[model samples]
Target: MVLQRLLLALINRAQLVERLAESKAIRRAAQLTAFAVIKGRLAGKQASARLRDSDTARMMREEARRMPQSAADAAQTVSRIRNTFMKEVKEGMREANRQIKDRK
Candidate 1:
């Protein structure tokens, strides 16, 4: 699956970043990968809510709290949160990777 490959890439690149700290492209790709993962998580939650069960409404309501203001803001909210998380994680990992390479 795509998720599996993304995880593999992240793990694989962690080592590459460890040794050489690959070009900015690799970092960008990793950030995008993180975004994709977060987007997938949100989508999965939405999908599960769609499969109505006893707690479907409650789950949807809970998810809505994390979402943005208007109905028109839904997609934008998801995109923003995912991107924010990706950026934050990428920055943290980059720092960690730099430390790792420095230690080498």
Candidate 2:
């Protein structure tokens, strides 16, 4: 739920940025946001792996069961997450652009 809210906020911000900024800047911001999410997930995985005996580790292990099982699957999952965010950003920008055009 929190992730969804964050993504929605990013989409709104991206829309606003698209109206007032260059394509490169908008792309950079989206990429940075995606990178942060991926980095945080990876950090959690690493920490959970290190703490194998704790209750938190047990929960993490259960959560890990829902994740991809192989390297290719993991890559695809991450790519999908990135693409989803990019799609939302593009959609927001398109909607904002359309609104601006309609007002003219």
Candidate 3:
């Protein structure tokens, strides 16, 4: 009985904290200093899509399995990974921008 009561109290405290954290003033104060808006839909299903479909992830796994033959190969690998990742980020940002425009 005592343990159950303690658990209930903890749950209530968590709920209260969540509510407080979502308050407009608190949220405004907690705004990300970087490009949070451009980081759209990156949790859950979206993250799964990134892992399964992103060229960057595929190339990373492929690169990890093999050693680079030379300095140029390593440099090329890095450049390809950078380009693939930037392309995805750009697409995500564009999607986010489109969503914002749709909302308005």
TM-score of each: 0.33, 0.35, 0.56
Best by TM-score: 3
What C-alpha lDDT, on a 0 to 100 scale, does residue 58 get in candidate 2?
54
Winner on lDDT (2 vs 3): 3
Kindly give the stretch of ten consecutive residues in candidate 2 with the minimal lDDT sum: 51-60
Q: Kindly indicate the candidate among 1 and 2 with the higher lDDT.
A: 2
lDDT of 3 by residue, 1-104 (tens): 99999878876897787987889977876686334654654466678976798888898999999999999999999999999999989998999999999999
Instruction: Kindly list the per-residue Cα lDDT of model 1 for residues 5-87, writing each as its tens digit.
Output: 98788778766657544677777888999999999999899767644432434444556777567877787655655675566
- The local lDDT score (0 to 100) that residue 45 gets in candidate 2 is 94
User: Which pairs of residues have clashing backbones in candidate 3?
Assistant: none
Q: lDDT of all the models against the reference?
A: 0.70, 0.72, 0.85
TM-score for candidate 3, residues paired by index: 0.56
Greater-TM-score candidate between 1 and 2? 2
RMSD of each: 18.6, 22.0, 10.1
